[model samples]
Target: MQRIRAFRARSTPDRPAPLRRAAAPAVAALALLLPATLSGCAAFGGERSGIVVTTNILGDITRSVVGDEADVTVLMQPNANPHSFGVSAQQAAELEEAELLVYNGLGLEEGVLRNVEAAEQAGTPSLEVAAGIDPLDFAEGESAGQPDPHFWTDPVRTGEAVDLIADAIVEQVGGIDEDRVRASADEYRGEVEALHAEAEERFAALPEERRKLVTDHHVFGYLADRYGFEVIGAVVPSGTTLASPSSADLKSLSDAVRDAGVPAVFADSAQPDRLTRVMAEEADLEIEVVPLFTESLTGEDGDAPTYLDMARYNTGAIADALAE
Candidate 1:
């Protein structure tokens, strides 16, 4: 189990200096000071139960592996942008009380990262899922050279994540049936492997030219790599949706769209489609804007309630849109 000093301002060697410095001093300081106090309090320690996951995607995966064995709490809500979603005070306190902390730690959760660090400072065992998997760097755009955090787009990589979570639960989380957790992971892994095979066949049916992808942001690097598609460009030109595209960036992307003759541009379902629509309109060509569940999952009544459902839905949506 990975452990850190109890409530100290520790350096994050994996992240850039700018991102490391982005941690709110006030929040970090409070977290640093309160872990001891939080731990010393009988109520806080007594309430520490189950696993706490950062993103809904990982939370769903964790639930699949954990089943009814342990209580799993997900911080990010349905249809919420992972880059901007935040936790409330009660939720923040729960971070310190988590039996294990799991997060997609390639800077995906910009809003809740400090809270994750706070939990780590409080001596909670953590699994940075993306770091454990072999991550690919953003090939181009504003976040070029940085590790791409959107690994969930690839089902094979997602299977690896399931294994990691199961291993963490058995090792870090106490009083759980390790055998049952392992069995659940194996079952889920089989499902993900099937999804990978399905995606391969689905993408293979498309013409080479149709395999090119344009999106609202630089989110499909892993998917493109996995399925042998080219990423033409993104409207935002950055990894996170929080970043805006300059006029020059928009014009450049629009020109690329026109040059490539891409018929459709995919936008995240959680975010507005205005930028994609603008890029499509500016291209002076017939371009369709398709919505995809790229970053977050949805409610039970929605299209993408689970990770598997999200992947299948996206695979079909991309195939159908590009094929047209």
Candidate 2:
């Protein structure tokens, strides 16, 4: 039997401060003031109304589909972990007032899901992108049977999401030309298809033995299933970044890494690579730690500023790490 020793949880960069009882009155005052201020801005043409997206990846996709018809406001910052990123009170209010709210559902956005639910209850039309796709279940451990929310890893599935998001934008958002939205979506779909083809070609070039992945977390299941790669194990055994890895989990993964002779362990660009480094050292192997844009997009000057760029960058990184 493996001994499971709990590791201390690391603080996420975007973790918000705790609400205090004494500050409740000030918070309530700000809550009341924000709407009126936002309303005034809208009246003065300072605020652009359109789609409000919870995650940066979905925000980029929505931007591609909408194409300046309406402004798209993304709540999460570039390279922030979606599972832990929280929105501001003003952003939450914007979610309520936006023409449509788009989120990567299936419990991926743990911190912001409550705001999404509130927006829905307030009668703002919303779309859960993962709800339209055939989601994969957790194949093992404590989160078994829950739907995997990282469907965007699969380009074909992401293309499906493009169509679904386009349709929703056309139907729900007023003042946008439906024909233009459809046309934009069609063009983007072709791009997605091309991306998928490129990825397939790159992945096919790798030898069968090299198509194995060990990662910081279980984030690549969809990509592995789509590209013929095997995810032997992850440093964190669960889908979400919020889950902590036990010492036994790390030891087991290290043993697997040694047995499989994996050349590299991949970590998300938005996350700390400490666990993966430790795992590699513990395995007593000369394994490299590669960073990939697995979850969120980055700043405009960054490598993965868009959905297409993110996929291309990730695919290339994976191939280079494994093929070498």
Candidate 3:
């Protein structure tokens, strides 16, 4: 895990108190310019607003729970990979002004953690939806040892995240009528459970020959564990984009793919599939490259744009490809 220092919005950069003595007059004047009320956090936008989420996945879940009752803004956007993000001054201001904040945890948002700390210091209450779900062990060998943060690969765990999200929203918003939030979250949870049951039935129908999964990245450990799929290998041998696979690692992955007779490698729609294509070609086998909505949902108009919609869409895709 990357270590990040804490920050307070608008606070002077830390320096020795000796230098501070010379600047006491300026510091006192600066303090009085922005009154305490403006410096501290209070009800955002109005006395009674709803939520502001930090990641795209948490943002979607928050929408499901808040419905139309609360205004929402996702700090990260679709097609933006969290691994390569850096926060700006404007966004820090946004966090300071927000009512409530939510983020996906388990070290998934390492790049944005500094900004998150800043938000917390500014008194914006933030909740991590992936708080209680079991994260997958990194199974792509020793070098792939980062903790797997992709819990939503399994619907059961995703349902757990949704439950936490509902609780946080209700906690933050006081009594803004949780009936809609509760009903919606419960309804979605039921759908996820039903989807899992259906996927089990379909996987059971497949001949054992087609139960192996290959992928461009070391994603889907949760899905494999939940549904009895054998995870043969991946082109990039790490649990996250921050790491790269070695030449020997690639050779080993190719050998494993060939030995297992795996037909295709699946990649996330939000990610490019070039590495999967290269792996397929090097393996000298007819490996299909398929994309699915795994990391982030599609744009609102596109298919699988919502969390509930992605649950149904991914279920159909996996069943279609893996079922015998």
On lDDT, the candidate that comes out on top is: 1
lDDT, candidate 1, 137-244, per-residue tens: 898999988888999999989999998888778765667899999999999999999999999999999999899899999999999999999999999999999999
Rank the models by TM-score, top first: 1, 2, 3
- lDDT against the true structure, per candidate, is 0.83, 0.79, 0.67
Separately for all candidates shown, the number of backbone clashes (residues 3 or more apart, or on different chains) is 0, 0, 0
What digit string (tens of lDDT, one per residue) describes model 2 on residues 1-324? 221111111223332111111123443344343311111111112232588888899998889988989889989999999899998899999987777777887778999878876765554556677756777876665566677889999999999989878877776677789999999999999999999999999999999999998888888889999988888998989988888899999999999999999999999987899998999999998999999999999999999999999999999999999988
Top candidate when judged by TM-score against the true structure: 1
Which 10 consecutive residues of model 2 have the lowest summed lDDT?
Answer: 35-44
Task: Give lDDT tens digits, candidate 3, residues 1-324.
Answer: 221111233423221011101123554354344322122233544643446677777788778777886788887777667666656787767765566667775567778877766766555656655545655567766435445678787888888877877766666665467888899889878877887787677777868788898876777888889888898977777666666778787788888888988776787787878767777787899877777777777787878777767766776676677652
**Against the true structure, what is each candidate's TM-score?**
0.88, 0.84, 0.80
Error of 1 at 133 (Å): 0.7
Could you tell which candidate, 1 or 3, scores higher by lDDT? 1
Model 3 spans > 4 angstroms off: 1-49, 142-146
User: Pairing residues by index, what is the TM-score of model 2?
Assistant: 0.84
Model 1 stretches astray by more than 4 angstroms: 1-47
Colliding residue pairs in candidate 2: none
Quality of model 2 by C-alpha lDDT = 0.79
Clashing pairs in 3: none
